[model samples]
Target: MVSKTDDKKAAPAAAAATAKPEEKKKVVSTIEEDDEFEDFPSADKEVIGWDAVEAAEKELNAWKDSWEDDDNETDFAVLLAAEKKKVSSAMKM
Candidate 1:
């Protein structure tokens, strides 16, 4: 037979079973809590390879001038279409 003290101890366990379970705290994501922002370097520093870049720029300008001279003589739309067809045919091979 169960003792009176054992019955009293058992009463709390039954009461605990009948009580509603505690709700868990909801977790918030860092992305939701903080504003989206990115820190990028400011373009204030003087570039080191300015001379080489300037030389390359001069070369590119001369090339572009020559290309423009050639383009003035040709029908650019026809040239582009022909080049595109050639490229597509080459890709197929």
Candidate 2:
């Protein structure tokens, strides 16, 4: 029953009816007092022993070796990254 002129007039009304109103959200204040702040545990100030230093060096070497092995394992690290992502997603399910 709507003529072309009537349809044009009704279009704006129909759009206005379906349109959502703008929402005003209250901004949360980020101001913090000294007492409100959490005290983080102080890290060890003492120097680490040679054994500890050696252990860290060994762990770093192991990681570097694994990285090198993976680089040798595939032609492109990009393919490996994609494969790793797929494996991670499958494990999640």
Candidate 3:
């Protein structure tokens, strides 16, 4: 009993209904791709706030100063080694 025009309209409506979930999936995929690198943060660890960042910066400055002053190569080497270890461990988290 449906006319050709009515069938065409209904077909498009049906297709659009199916496409909505596909559209949602596409949007979710886009979000996932955008956040690919966002998985580094861990639920158990406290968020690295400004204070932690500042502390790390101070430690790095100390290391740099030791390197520049050349007052003790052993101290500078120790600082350099500790900094490398800290960085490598943080990268695993």
Candidate 4:
């Protein structure tokens, strides 16, 4: 029943109806190889002064002394309150 002209017109319509829509791919840009180390600074080559070293040692010694004093105290209530406060703060975070 179809003529050549009618078949030609219907051919395109039929093809279009059966064809699936193309999915668009997302493009993501990556950091260039040369810029990988650009965010970090160069290694420090300078020597630390003796005064700064002595001060750090003193601070660490003070912390050790405080820890020893705490060990002698054996206060369960204070330890429990500190733990509860730490847990509450962590939960909030």
Candidate 5:
């Protein structure tokens, strides 16, 4: 029974009636303090031994050789980075 102009006017009013007013959230203040512990100093001061470094270098060289052997496949370093991401995500969960 309503004309097109009436329908158009009613549409906006209907929309406005159904529209929800946005809620204003309160600003909350929180204090975040970092506590220092004895273990932290120990962690910061810990020294890496030369023997450990040598062992790590040997293991790294072995891994490099194995990766170089697969020249036809995806790069070895890229695979290592992808594996690292997977491990990091798993730890987060």
Candidate 6:
């Protein structure tokens, strides 16, 4: 029994009534500290021999050689500076 104009007006109202409410997004706090252990038993750690050190150096060189120039390469000095800045800022906080 509704007219065309009445149906058009009621359509939007019906849609609005049937629409679901937006869900609230979860907020993560940057201030929260991780529960991971900071200090480990370094004094009781096994000492590496020259052979182990040489092997580790060879492995590191191989890993470094695997990187290509297109990997968005960054200078170690720049990265170190950024890390130092972050540490200084955190210390201030």
Best by TM-score: 3
RMSD of each: 27.3, 28.5, 22.8, 28.6, 29.6, 26.7
* lDDT of each residue in 1-93, candidate 4, tens digit only: 333544545655555435522211111234354344432211211333465565466443434434435443358867887899999999999
| Over 4 Å off, model 5 | 1-74
> How far does residue 55 in candidate 4 sit from its true spot (Å)?
66
Q: What's the C-alpha lDDT at position 22 in model 2?
A: 25
Task: Find the 10 residues in a row with the least total lDDT in model 6.
Answer: 20-29
Query: Each candidate's lDDT (Cα)?
Result: 0.48, 0.47, 0.57, 0.47, 0.46, 0.48
Shift of residue 40 alpha carbon in model 5, Å: 67
lDDT of 6 by residue, 4-62 (tens): 54444555555543552221111123333344343432322334336655545644343
Give the lowest summed-lDDT range of ten residues in model 1. Answer: 20-29
Return the TM-score for each candidate structure.
0.21, 0.21, 0.22, 0.21, 0.21, 0.21
For model 2, how does the per-residue alpha-carbon lDDT over 11-79 read when each residue is reduced to its tens digit? 555554355222111112333333254432222213334655654564434344344453534657778
Candidate 3 regions with alpha-carbon error over 4 angstroms:
1-73
Worst 10 residues of 4 by lDDT: 20-29
Candidate with top lDDT is: 3
TM-score of 5: 0.21
Model 4's alpha-carbon lDDT is 0.47
CA displacement after TM-score superposition, residue 66 of candidate 6 (Å): 26
Each candidate structure's count of clashing pairs: 0, 0, 0, 0, 0, 0
